[model samples]
Target: MEQKDQLLQKVWLWSLLFFLVAAFTGFVYRWGLIGGDILGLRMSNVRHAHSHLMFFNWVTPVPLVFMARHLMKTAPEAYSSLKWCITVIILIGFASYPFFLIYGYHPVQIGTANLPFSVMLSGLVMIGWYWFGLIYLKYRNKADSSLSQLFYDGALVMLVVSSLGAWGVAVAQFGNIDNNLISGALTHFFLTTFTEGWCVLAAIGIFYDLSKKNYSLPVDKNWLIAPIVLGAPLMFPFGLSVDLLNESLLWTAKFGSLLVGIGLGINLWYMARALPSRNKVIWLFVLAMLALKVTIQLSAVFLPETLWLGQHGLRVLYLHLMLLGFVSTLFFAAFHTVNTRSSKAGVYLFLGSVFVLIATLVLISGLWPPAWQPTNVYRWVTVGAILPSIAIAVELVVAGYSRFKQG
Candidate 1:
C-alpha cells in the first residue's frame, strides 16, 4: 500500500515537472528569447517535446494512477508491475525527448533513429494497457462498485482503441508505404482517436470519480458511452477521405463538435448546480472550461478554411487553446482535487491557473488578425505565458506537499 502511494506520488511529481517544462518553453518561445521560426525544425522539435510530455507524461498517467487506486484493492500484481513499467518508460522517454529537440529531429525520425528506445517505450505503454484492461475486466466481472467500474470499463475500451490507432500511425510513419491513402488514413486515425477518443473518455471517467464524491448529480452511463458508439463508425469513413463525404463530412464534423460541446456543457452545468454556493473556484473553473470548449468548436469550424486564417498560425493557435486551455486546465483541476482533498489552497491554485490560461488564449488568438503587428502580439503572449507557469508551479508544490503530509 505504501509503495503504491509512493508510485502515485512520483507520477504526480513527473506530471508537474513535464508540465512546467512545457509552460516554460512556451513562455520563452513567445518572448523571442528562443530565436526560430514557429514552423521550422527547431520549433517542431520543441513542440514535439511539449506534446509528448503533456500527453504521455502528464495526461496518460492520471487515469492510470486513478485506476491504480481500485486495482490495488483487487489486482495488486497488475497494479504494481504496471506502475514500475510506466515509471521507467516515462523517465527514458523524457530523457530522450531533449536529445531529439537538440538535434532538431522530427518525432518519427527520432523514433526510427532510436528504434530500441522507441520499442521499449511502446512495450511499456502496452504493458500498462494490458494490465489496466485486465484489472478493469476483472472488476467488471466481479461487479463490485458500479460507478467506478463502469467508468473504468469505458476508459479501458477507449485506451485500447487509442493505442491501436497510435500503433497504426507509427507503422505508417516508419514502414515503407507507397500509398498516400494508407498514410493519410493512419494519420487521421491517430489524431482523432487520441484527441477525441482517449482524452474525452479519460476525462469523463475523472469527472465521474470527482463529482460523485462531492455532488449528488445523476450519472448517465449513456452519455459516457454515446461518443464511442457514434465515433467508431463515423471515424471510419471520415478517416478514409475528408473529401469522400465532401460537404457532408464538414457538416458531420461540425455537428459532432456541437454534440460534444452540448454533452460536456451538460456535465459542467450539472456540476455547477450541484456544488455548494461557497465553491467559487470550481464554478469559475467550470466556466473557463466551457468557454475553452466553445473556442475549440469555433476553431474547428475555421480549420478547413485555412486560406482565410493563414492555415499554419491559426491551426497552431487552435490546437494550443484546445490542448493548453481546455484539456490541461481541466486535468489540473482534477489533479488538485485528488491531491489536496479540495482544500482552499487547491481551489485558489485552480482559479489562478484558469485566469492566466484565459488571458493567454485571448492574446494568442487575437494575434491571428492580419493587421496585428507581430512585435506587440509576441509581447502580450510572452507576458500571458509567464502567469500560467507561475500559477501551475505554485499549485503543484502545494498539492504535492499536501499529498505527502496526508500519506
Candidate 2:
C-alpha cells in the first residue's frame, strides 16, 4: 500500500509540473495575442505546443495513473507492466513538447527523408496509449464489471479509435490531399474524439473510482457508455469546415451532437447524485462547465447563427472548458484529497482565473451583448491568461516547501 501511494504521489506531482508548464505556455500564447513576441515564435506554433502538452502530459497521465492503480488492486501481478507503461507514456509525453514547439508539424529533413517531427512524436504517444490499452485489456477480465470499469474500457477504446483520426491526418498530409473537407474532417475528428471521448470518459471513470463509496443510487450499466461510443465519431462535424460540408454530413453531425449531449447529460445527472458530501462546491462547478459545454455544442449545431457568433472563438472557449475547466479542476479536487496542504489562496486564484478567462473568451467570441464588449479585447484576455499560471506557480511553491519539510 505504501508503494502504491508513493507511485501515485510521484505521478501526481509530475502531472502538476506538466500542468504548470502548459499553463505558462498558455500565458505566452496569450501574450502573443497582445502582440508580445518572444524568441520569434509564431503564435500558432506556441499554441500547438501549449495544447499538446496539456493533452499528452497533463490530462492524459493523471487519469492513467488512477486507472492503473485501480487495476493493480485487483491484479497485483500486472503492476510492473502498468508501471513501465506509465513511465514510457510520461517520457514520450515530455519528449514531445520541444518537437511541437519548434516544428509544429512541419516536415524536417532527416538526411534524404523529410519527416514531420511532431507527427512522428505524436505517433509514439499513440503507441504509448495502445500499450496502456493492451495492459488494461489483459487484466480487465480479472477486474469486476462495475461502472468505473465500464468507463475505463470505453475510454480506452476511444483512445485507440481516436488514433485513426490522427493517422487520417498524416495520410492527408503525406498524400498531398488538397480537399479541405478531408483535412478539416480528419482534424476535427481527432480533436473531438480525443478530448470529448477519451478525456471526458476517463475523468468520469476516475470520479466514480475515487468517489464510489459515496454513490448510493444505482445507475444503469449501459446508459453511460452507449451514447458516447455511437456519437463521438460523428460529432466531429460540429467543428469541421462548415462551408465544405453538404447537407447530409451537416445533419449527421448535428445528430451526433445531440446524442453526445444526451450521454453527457445522463452522466452529469448521475454524477451529481453521487457527489461526495464534502467538496460539493468544486464538483458542482466542474459539472456546470460540462453542462454548459454540451449546451453550447448543441446550440452551435441547431442554430446556424449561434455557430456564426463564436465559431472561431467558441472552439477555443470549448476546448478550455473541457480541458482546464472540467478536466483540470477535477484533477485538482482529486489531488486535494491526497494532499490537504494545497494552498487555499492558490485554489481560489485558479478558480477565479478560470471564470475570468471564460468570461473574456465569451466576450471575445462576440457572444456577449455589443454594449458589454470591451474596448480592448486582447488586454482582458491576456490578464485572464496570466492569472492561472500565477495561481499554479503558487501551488507549486507550496508543494515544494511541503516536500522539503518532509525530506
Candidate 3:
C-alpha cells in the first residue's frame, strides 16, 4: 500500500510538471500573439507545442495512473507491465515536447538524414498506449466486470481508433500528399475522437469508480456507453472542413452529435445525483462545462453557419472547454477524493482560475456580439493563463516540500 501511494504521488507530481510547462507554453503563445515573435519561434510551432504537450503528457497519462490503481486492485498480476507502460509513456511524452516546440511536425536534419523527431516520438507514445490497452485485455478475465470496466473498454478502443487517424496524418505528410480534404479530415478525426472519445469517457469512468460508494439510485449502463463509442468516430469530421464530408457524412456526424449530447446529458444527471455533498461545488462546475459543451455541439449540428464562420475561434474555444474546463477540473475533483491532504484554498484557486480562463476564451471565440469585444482581449487571456499556471506550480511545490519534511 505504501509503495503504491508513493508511486501515485510521483505520477501526480510528474503530471503537474507537464501541466505547468504546457500552461507556460500556452502563455507564451498568447504573449506572442500580442507582442509578435517569441524568442524567434513561430507562433504555429509554439501553438502545436502547447497543445501536443497537454494532450500527450498531462491529460492522457494522469487519468491512466488513476485508472491503473483501480485495475491494479482487480488484477494484481498486471502491475509490473502497467508500471513500465506508464513510465515509458510519460518519458516519451516529455521528450516529445521540445521537439514539437522547435519544429512542430517538420523534419530535422540529423547526421545528414532528415528525421521527423516529434512525429516519431508521438508514434512511440501511441505504442505505449497500445501496450497499456493490451495489458488490460490480457488481464481482463482475471477481474470481475462492471459498468466502470465497460467504459474503460470503450475508451481503450476509441484510443486505438483515434490512433489510426493520427497515423493517416503521418502517412500523408511522408507521401507528400497534396489533398487538403484528406489532411483536414484525418486531423479533425484524430482530434475529435481522441478528445471526446478517449479523454471524456475515461474521465467519466474514473469518476464513476471513485464515487461509486455514494450511489443508491439504479443507473442505465448501456445508455451511458453506447453513444460515445458509436458516435465519437462519426462526429469527428464535423469540424472546420465540412466540405470534405458529403451530405451523408455530415448527417452521420449530426446524428452522432445528437446521440453524444443525449448521452452526456444522462451522464450529468447521474453525476449530480452521486456527487458527495461535501465538495460538490467544483464537480458541479465541471458538469456545467460538460453541459455547455454539449449545447455548443448541438448548435453546430443545427446551425451550420456558426461552424463555418467561427471555425478558428469557436474550435479553439471548444477544445479548451473540453480539455481545461472539463477534464482538468474532473481530475482535480478525483485527486481531492483520493488525497485528502490537498489544500482547500489551492482547490478554490485552481477552480477560480479555470473559470476565468474559460470565460476569456469564450469572449475571444467570436461567439459574443461584435460590440462586446474587449479592447484588452490578449491581456485578459494572458492573466487567465498565468493564474492556472501559478496555481499548479504552487501546488506542486507545496506537495514536494511536504514530502521532503516527511522523508
lDDT of each: 0.59, 0.81, 0.82
- Kindly list the per-residue Cα lDDT of model 3 for residues 365-389, writing each as its tens digit: 8777869877887888888878899
Model 2 / residue 301 / CA error / Å: 4.2
Model 2: per-residue Cα lDDT at residue 192: 84
Which residue window of length 10 is worst by lDDT in model 1?
233-242
Candidate 1, residue 123: Cα displacement in angstroms equals: 6.2
Tell me how many clashing residue pairs each candidate has: 0, 0, 0
Ranking by TM-score: 3, 2, 1
Q: How would you encode candidate 2's per-residue C-alpha lDDT over 109-185 as one tens digit per residue? A: 88999978888888898899999988888888998777888899888888888889999999999999998888989
| Alpha-carbon shift of residue 379 in model 3 (angstroms) | 1.9
As for lDDT, the candidate ahead, 1 or 2, is: 2
Q: Give each model a TM-score.
A: 0.76, 0.93, 0.94
Name the lDDT value of residue 387 in candidate 1: 74
lDDT ranking of the models: 3, 2, 1
The residue ranges of model 3 lying beyond 4 angstroms of the native Cα positions read 214-220, 242-246, 304-309, 405-407
Q: In terms of TM-score, which candidate is stronger, 1 or 2?
A: 2
Q: For model 3, state the Cα shift of residue 262 in Å.
A: 0.9
Candidate RMSDs in order:
4.8, 2.1, 1.9
Question: lDDT tens string, model 1, 35-113?
Answer: 5355444655566556666666666776677666556655556655667656754675566556545543333455446
Estimate the TM-score for candidate 1.
0.76
